[model samples]
Target: MESRNPVIRRYADFQKPGSVLGNNQGRYDGNVITSTPVDETTQTFPGRTPAKPGERVVTMDDVVMKSFAMLALLLVGAFVGWNAPGLAIIAAIAGLVLGLVNTFKKNVSPVLVVAYALLQGVFVGGISYIYQNLVVADGTNIVGNTIMCTMVAFGTMLFLFKSGIIKVDAKFTRMMMVAMVSYLVIAVISIIASFMGVGGGWGFYGVGGIGILLALFGVGLASFSLMLDFQSIRQAISMGLPEKESWRLAFGLTVTLVWLYLEMLRLFAILAGRRE
Candidate 1:
């Protein structure tokens, strides 16, 4: 009966106090699936092993699934607030505060995490509503385009991480943050100039010839954010962290991915608007 409980089921290693499972030290035997652990195998005692070397024996799926579940709750929350108008704004503020709280906390709390997700949904859905109603795209394809671009950017990032194409280093993260801040500063200045009826250079809004430059810069920001997410995943895997962490991973990814998509959307909009 205890085995059926979600929390207890994950404590299998804990249940066995003196064995390798309890001590947290794996004893690799020659056979991969046998009751012993080998250099490249994880024992699935009393039956199977990881099966192959260099294979991902541990995945972030647990985190991803839980994260999506939070997101699902968020979307429902968004729908409720969307039809109600003022509620979304309230939710947005609450979401922002929760986001900061979650980011600073070392341990993940399902309640806060889920609450944050729902709050963030309001912000996203609100923006989607504005874009659909105000912007002109290929009819019903704007939302689809946004979603597609987001998924593609995310998938590309995941592929790069898996293929050893992008190495995550402390220096890399610092440089990326510097560049991102610079971009944000420039964007703010451009808006200020526009308000004054003065035109600045093309660096901020993809105006002049700097639009592509800004686009690449946005991509770099998203990529570095991915690196940080990967770092967290690595730590969780090594520490035998809880399976619920998968939700946190997904939340982090969704944040970065959504930011990347918006940047790309703006870049495209700038280019398309110019062409028109």
Candidate 2:
């Protein structure tokens, strides 16, 4: 399986022949007809009707449910963090560490994934509160606008992916990877320059015509990342991954969505700042 998404690539390592769709053997009784014993083959498992064999394989519904559960926990954490923005720095650090741990570990731990989601929610909520305070006073609901835009982008990407309009091929995946690396390099440089007091307000990000462009690029990147995620989930389902892997899928999606939301928030902040 060719996938640019790191989570999918990692999970794909676990797949084996017959691991996805196991072979079915008919039930045999002691009765013999001629030289061979009589065997009963049924479409459903014993005591279960209408449900085909291997029906318990992973499904989109499982991924969606797991994703929703994680989101719900994140919302709860966000509510708590929004009321206490001072903890944003700590939450951000913790979230980053947890994210790295979850990403590198071979076996998925539901507890750790949930913990990471909660920490991310805290970081998001705290930063959102800060951004709202800074930009909302200008009579613009930056946070609300960002949320709406993120949802719109997500829906658009999902539609495009599911409709087969945006195919995930090796070439496309390579291009996306290159673009992401370039963007990350720029971001790192900007952060360093900001710390050194170079380029003032937005550092390299705020240079003439750069700030808005970077923001647009970031939004686009995050949206495309979501598409990669969709492809990963679709592939996982088609390959009949175990249901337990749903947590990994959910974690990956949550991470991308949070990235999208943050980028949207930053874009709006820049615009609001310019307006003021």
TM-score of every model?
Answer: 0.66, 0.81
Best by lDDT: 2
- lDDT on C-alpha atoms for all candidate structures: 0.55, 0.72
Per-residue lDDT tens digits of candidate 2, residues 34-100? 2222122111111111122444555778899999999998888888789998888999999989888
TM-score between candidate 1 and the true structure: 0.66
Give the alpha carbon lDDT tens digit for every residue of 1-276 in model 1: 222111112223222323223333333233222333232222122112222432333345666677578658766765765565456577778877887776556665778877777777776666565555545453454555766776777678778877878865545545555665677777778777667654333335545666567676776676556656665565445434335555555666556655665576665555545654
For model 1, the superposed segments whose C-alpha errors exceed 4 Å read 1-59, 77-89, 137-140, 197-203
Worst 10 residues of 1 by lDDT: 1-10
Clashing pairs in 2: none
Tell me the lDDT of model 1 at 106. Answer: 60
